[model samples]
Target: MRHTKLGRTDIDVSQICLGTMTWGSQNTQDEAFAQMDYALDHGVNFFDTAELYPTTPLSAETYTLTESIIGNWIATGGKRDKIVLATKIAGSGRPYIREGQPITAKAVHQAVDASLARLKTDYIDLFQIHWPNRGHYHFRQAWNYDPTKQDRSTAVSDMAEKLEALGECVKAGKIRAIGLSNETTWGTQKFLSLAEERGLPRVATVQNEYNLLYRTHDLDMAELSYHEDVGLLAYSPLAGGILSGKYLDGRKPAGSRGTINGDIGGRLAPQQQAPTQAYVDLAHAHGIDPSALAIAFCLTRPFMAAAIIGATTMEQLKVNIGAADIVLSDEILKEIARIHRDYPMPI
Candidate 1:
C-alpha cells in the first residue's frame, strides 16, 4: 500500500483506508476481523469508522459496537501500535445518542470517553465530527438542500465551540488530530479560518462522498484540498458496490447492499444504471476487474489522501485493495472522461 502524510501531521497513513462501517451489522465480528487482518497484512494501516457506523442499520442497541470489535481485536492481537485508527462522533440527528442534541463541549467529552473505553485505548489517533450540526448537501440530499435558512452567526459560533472542544481533546491527549465529514466547501473554510484565528485544532481531513457517480467535490472542494492542504478521505468510491455491475438489470444478489438496505444509501438508484454500466464495461474492455477499476478511478485525483474501502466478504476486500496498485493509462482516463459527460449527476 502507498503511504501519504495525513494533512500536515507527522503520521503517515495508507492510501487505502480500511472502512469499518459494515462491521457488527452487515458483517460479523469474525468477518470484520478477517478483513482487518488481511488488510493489515497487505500494509493497509489506516482504518476509519464512526460512532454511527454499521448504518446498513444504525441503532441504539448497536451503538459503538463497531468500535468494540476493533478494540477487541487490538486487545487480543496486540496490534494497536501497528494501526492508525480514525473514528467519528455522530452529530445531532439520532435521539438515542445524547438525546440527539447538537455538538457541544460536553457532548465531545462524553463521546471521547465512551469511545475510549469501548475502543480499549487511552488515546484515539484521529477523531472527527460525523457531520455538521447545520447540515450540508451530502448523502443524496443535495438535490433539494436549502442553505439560505441557516443562521450565519449561529453556524460560526457552533463551529468555534466545537473547535474549542477539539482543542481541549488535543491538549488532554485524547485525540491526535481532528477532521470533518459530510461538510461543504464553505463549512470547511470556516473551520480552517477559526482554527487559524483562535489557535485551535486545524482540520486535518474531510471525509465526504466522492465517487464516479458523485463528483460534486471535483469542482470547489478540490480547490480547497489543493490550496488549503486538507486532503479528501473519499468514501463510497464504489458507490455502495453499484459499480461492480452485479446489481445491473435490477439484480440484487442475496446479501448485497441493495437487497438488504433497499437503496444502497441512495447510490443504487434506477437513474444510475447507465453511468455504472459505462464504467463496468470500460473496466472489462481493458481487462481489469470492474470493482478495482471503480476504486482506482477515485485514487486518480491528486487531492485524494485515502480512499476508504469497505467489504462484507474477504474476496471483495482483496479486490478493492488491489486498486491501489493499478494506475490508469492516459487512453483509459480519457475514455472515463468521455463516459462522465454522458451521465453527469447520476444520483
Candidate 2:
C-alpha cells in the first residue's frame, strides 16, 4: 500500500504493481476480476500488462485476450481512473506480431492504437516497449549474449523514430508516460538522451526481471536509475515462483507456473534448484513465507519504483499483497546477500 512517485512524474503509484499476464491463460476473467478488485481494495493503484500477455504458451489465439479482459472490466463499471494502467508494445522477433518486424514509427502508431482500443481507455498511464528491436541480453539469453554485432547508428535512429511516434501519441492524449522493458543500461541512457535532445517523451521507467535468484539490475541498471531519475519496475520478483519453494523436492503442485511452462523460460537450470532450496530453508528458519521475503527484498531496493507481482489465484494474490507490509531486517538482508554471493545467477 506504500506509494512512490513514478520516476520524475507527479503521479504516485503503489509500491506493488499488479501484473496481469495470467489473466486469459492461467486464470479466467472472473479470477482476473477478483484479483484486480482485491488489489484495488488493498491500495494497489498500479497495474502492468502487455500486448503479448496471458503468456503461458504465448499463442497467437490468446495474444490480446488479457487486454480484452481489462476492457471488459472497464466496460462493466470498473473505474478507469482509479488505477494507473501500464501496457507494452511487443518488440521485434515475434511472428504473431507484425510478422516479426522491427518496431518503427508506423508500428508504434498501430500498436498504441490497438492497445488503447483493446483496453477501452482513451489514454494509458504508461506505455512501454516490451523489448529492444536490436536486442541485448534478456530472458535467459545472457550466457550467449554478444553485443558486438549491434549497429549503433541504426539503434539510435530507431529510438528517435519511436520517440517521435510516442510524442505524437502524447499530443493525441493516447498515453501519459513512456517506459522501457527488458532493456539494458546503455539502451535506457540512449533513450533518455534522445528524449532530452528532441524534447520528446521522457523515459519514465524500466521494467526488468529482478528477484532473489536474478539480480541483473543490481549492477549498471541500478546506478543508471539512481542518477537518471528513471525508476525500476521489477518483474518476476519471485523468480517465476522459484523463490516460493513450491517446486522444490520434486513437487510440481498442479497449476503452478512450472507445470504450465515446464522450464519457466530456462529459469530451472540444474544448478538453480539447490540455491532455491537454501533460500526456502532460510525463509522457513526465520518463520517467514518465501514469497513475502522475496517481494519484501524487492521493495527494499534503493532504485525500485515498484515490484510487479502476478498470481493465478486469489490466495496467491493475498499472500503477495501482504508482502508490502513485511520489512526485511538488516540481519536478514545480510543473510540474503551471503546466499546471493554463494550462488549468483543460478539461472
Candidate 3:
C-alpha cells in the first residue's frame, strides 16, 4: 500500500484506509478480525471508524460496536503502534449521542475518553468531528442546501471553543491531530483561520463523500485541499457500491449494503443508475474490475490523501485493496471524464 503524510503531521498513513463501518452489522467479529488481519498483512496501516458505526441500519443499539471490535483486535496483541488510527465523534443529530447536542468543549472531552476506552488505546492518531454543528450538504442534501441562515460570529465562536477542547486533548496526549468531516469550504477555511489566529489545533483533514457519482469536492473543496494541505479522506468512493455494478441489473444481492438499506442513503435514485451503469461498462470494456476502477480513480486525484473502503467479506476486501496497484491509463481516464460530463450529479 502507498503511504502519504497526513496533512503536515509526522505520521504517514496508507493511501487506502480500511473503513470499519460494517464491522458489527453486516460482519461478525471474526469477519472483522480477518479483514483487519488481511489489510495489515497487505500493508494498510490506516484505519477509519466512528463513534456511531456499524451503520448499515444505523440504530442506537448497535452504536459503537464497530469501535469495540477494533478494541478487541487491539486487545488480542494487534500492533497498535504500527497503524495510524482515525475516528470521529458524531455531531448533533443522533438522539443516542448526548441527546443530539451540538459539539462543545465538554462533549469533546467526553467523546475522546469514550472513544479511547472503546478502542483500547491511550491516544487516537487522528480525532475528527463527524459533521458541523449547524448542518451539512452531504448525505444527498446538496440540492436543497442553503447557507444564508448561518450565523458567522456564533459559528466562529463554536469553532474556537472546539479547537480549545482539541488543544486540551493534544496536551493530555489523547489525540495527535484533529480533522473535520461533512464540512464545507467556508467551514474548513474558518477552522483553519481560527486555529492560526488562536494558536489552537489546526484542521488536518476533511472527510467527505467523494466518488464517481459525487464530484462536488472537485470544485472549491479541491482547491482548499491543494492549497491548505487539508487532504481529503474520501468516503464512499464507490458511491455506496453502486459503481460496482452489482445493483445495475435490478439484482440486489443478498446481504449487500443496498439489501440492508434499501435507498443506499439516497444515493441510488433513478437518475444515478444510468451513469453508474456507464462507469461499470467502462471498467468492463477496459478489462478492469469496476470496484477497483472506482477506487483507483479516487487515488489518482491530486487532492486525495486516502480512499476509505469498507467491505462485508474478505473477497470484497481483497478486490478493493488491489485498487492501490491498479494504474488507470489516459485512455481509461478520458472515458471516465466523458461519462462524468454526460451525467453529472446523477444522485
Candidate 4:
C-alpha cells in the first residue's frame, strides 16, 4: 500500500482509504470489524466514515450508526494509533440532525464533540464538512447547479465563522485537520483563504465523486489541487459499482447498491451503458478485474491522495485493497482514455 502526505500535513495515509458507509445497515458490527481488521492487515491505514452513513437508504433510525460501530471497534482494542481515521459532519438538509440547519460556528463545535464521543477517540485525524450549506454540483445536481442565487458575502461570512469554530476545536485537541466534501472550487479556495488570514486550520483535502463516468474533478479542481496542495480524496472510483459492470444490462443483483438505491442517484442514464460496457470489456481484454482497473485508474490521477473504496462483502474488500498495488500500464491507460472520450460524462 503506497502512502502519501495528507495535503501539507505530516500525517501519511494509504492510497486506499476504507469507506464505511455500508456498516450498520447493509452489514453487521462483526462484518465491519472484520473488514477493518482485514484492511489494516493489508496496509489500509485510512478509514472514512460519516455522521449520516449506512446511506444506501438513509433514514433517521440508522443515523450515526456507522460512527458508533467504529467506536465499538476502537473500544475493543488499541489499534487507533495505527489508523488515520477520517469522518464527516453532515451539512444541513437532514431534518433529524439539528432540524436540517445549516452549519454554523456553534454547529461546528457541537458536531466535532459529538463525533469524538461517538468514535470513542481523543481526536479525529481528519474532520470534513460533508457538503456546502449553499449547495453546488454534487450528488447528481450538476445538470441544474445554478449558483447565481447564492449570497457570496454571506457564504464567506459563514465560512469564516466555521473556520473560527474549527480553530477552537484544533486548540482544544478535538480534531487534527479539516477538509471539505462535495464542494466547489470557489468554496475550497474561500476556506483556504479564510484559514490563512485567520491562522485557523488549513483545508487539507476535498472528498468528491471521481470516477470514469463522473470526471468533474479532473478539470479545474485538479488545477486547484496542484497549486493549493489540497489533495483529492476520490470517492465512488467505481461509479457506485457501474464501472464494475455488475449493473449492466439492467441487471440489479439482490442486495446490491442498485437494488437498494435505485439507479444510484440518477447515474444509470441511458447513455451510460455503452461506455460502462466498453470499460468493462477493456479491462477483461487486458486480463484485469474491471473494478481493480477502475480503482487503479483513479490512483493514477496526479492530484489523488486516496481513492475511497467501499465493499459490502469481504471478497470485494480484498479486491479493492489489491487495487492499490495494480499499476495501470500505458496501454490500459490509453484504452481508458479512448473509452472515456467515446462516452464522456455519460452519467
CA lDDT scores, all candidates in order? 0.91, 0.91, 0.93, 0.93
RMSD of 3: 0.9
| Per-residue lDDT of model 4, residues 35-138, tens digit only | 99999999999999999998978999999999999999999978999999999888999999989999998888888999999999999999999998888899
Total backbone collisions for each predicted model = 0, 0, 0, 0
Q: After superposition, how far is residue 171 of candidate 2 from its true place, in Å?
A: 1.2
Instruction: Write the number of the candidate with greater lDDT, choosing between 2 and 3.
Output: 3
**TM-score, cand. 4:** 0.99
Instruction: Give the per-residue lDDT digits (tens) of candidate 1, residues 1-347.
Output: 78998888987999999999878888899998899899999989999987887777778888788999998998999999999999999999799999999999889988999888888998998899999999888998888899997888799999999899999999999999999999999999999999999999999999999888888889999999999989999999988889899999989998888877888878878899998889989999999999999889888999999999999988899999999999999999999899889888998
User: Which residue pairs in candidate 3 collide?
Assistant: none
List pairs with backbone clashes in candidate 2: none
How far is each candidate from the true structure, as Cα RMSD in Å? 0.9, 0.9, 0.9, 0.7
| Candidate with more favorable, higher lDDT: 2 or 4 | 4
Candidate 1: TM-score? 0.98
Q: What is the TM-score of candidate 3? A: 0.99
Superposition TM-score, candidate 2 onto the true structure: 0.98
Clashing pairs in 4: none
Model 3, 16-105: lDDT tens per residue? 999999989899999999999999999899999999998988999999999999999988955898889999999987889999899999
